[model samples]
Target: MSLLESWDRGEHTAETLRGTTATYATYRKGSGPGVVVIHEIPGLTPDVIAFGEEVVAAGFTVVMPHLFGRPEAGLSPLAVAGAMRQVCVSREFTKLATGETSPVAGWLRSLARELHTELGGPGVGALGMCFTGGFALAMMVDESVAAPVLCQPSVPFVPGRRRGADLNLSPADLGVVRERAAAGCQVLGLQYAGDPLTGTRFDTLAGEIGDAFLRVDLPGRRHSTVTTHRQQEAVDRVLAFFTERLS
Candidate 1:
């Protein structure tokens, strides 16, 4: 059997989330508070969906947006490369630039607002991984996004020292995010200490958000926290953060 076939599964329904400027196909499952799971550069693969299922099992509505790649495509080198190429040229993502939020973040914020309106909670949760990781922080400018989790956020490609610490947010957006953090909204971040792609963004987050940033820095070169690298402690921490914030 395929590795995906052996994992825990949940019933999910697919829907189109119509945003102000874009539309996304979203897979949703479970119930309670809403949590949007933004996949990495390679799209919404099986492992990403499995992580979403874990969120659902934790008693929250999990929405996985199909950013790129085949939804059920397992981890394949070719698939990852294709998705990376697409992201590199797509106007939606800010691939090799600093001090700018990706255009898709606005759409994600819209999705979160709509979900919060429909689900009726204190606010919604957002978890972004890899290329999309800092997006959750960008969404935090809006009060509707209460729980923001960034995992291995790599953007502007981390080619230099400045890009390494850039949060991929515009000045105005960063200012608002800082204000929100000061207002008592905590942000959770997870990453391996030795991952080059992540750079020193965690330090930037800590410096900007002060005590409101809770960082879980694992020791190693592993990248993906919930998959690939697969740190159970990180996964547990994420679940606990969600439960504490979303519940």
Candidate 2:
């Protein structure tokens, strides 16, 4: 049997997307406004796929890229740990930088642009979860990304006071983000009220983007507001946001 055969691809068609730095297999499904669902660490677990289907059913084309790990692996502790190790060493990810965005965001932007070009809408939406959560924010630098949703954005290894609030963006990039928000691109953020993994970045985002950063704080200390923890309210709000923005 093929190594990839064991993985359930569901209704998504396997394709390839290339950018300046990286190229990866993309599983695309649905037809309408495009939404790029970037998987978190541990790769595209079943949890993420289920959520992507949620978006697809809500009337948006969803493309999930297999960034690392087995495309369809169990969401075991070992799987998460293994993916975390890979992310820690991967050149595409910026795990501990205070003022820079991850390199993978570039490729994500390219994907969003390609989707927008194909669909011919105002723009496409980009939703990043957990480890890739802040990536949606970085993808906002591009004009092709109209709707950016960040779920429990944990990045720059926010342990200290400085990194805790870092936006995982360079000064210039942060400025561009601010400018984009000023020009009317609203950024949606979802997370728990007390998620330590998310640090103080929400406060930082509020301070940086002002009212343009729509904050949706769910109750509890859990991470993964949309996937692992699976908040219904958060999920509803996400679909609504896509409807209002992408639809």
TM-scores, each model vs. reference: 0.91, 0.91
Of candidate 2, the 10-residue stretch with the lowest lDDT total is 10-19
TM-score of 2: 0.91
Model 1 steric clash total: 0
Candidate 2 overall lDDT versus native: 0.85
| Candidate 1 segments exceeding 4 Å error | 1-20
Summing lDDT over every window of 10 consecutive residues in candidate 1, give the lowest-scoring window.
Answer: 11-20
lDDT of 2 by residue, 1-247 (tens): 4333433343322222223446677888888999989988788887887898899889998888788877768789999899888887878888888998887777777788888999988899999988889999999999999999999888877688887788888888899999999999999999999998888999999999899999999988988888889989999999999889886
* Cα shift from native, residue 126, model 1 (Å): 0.3
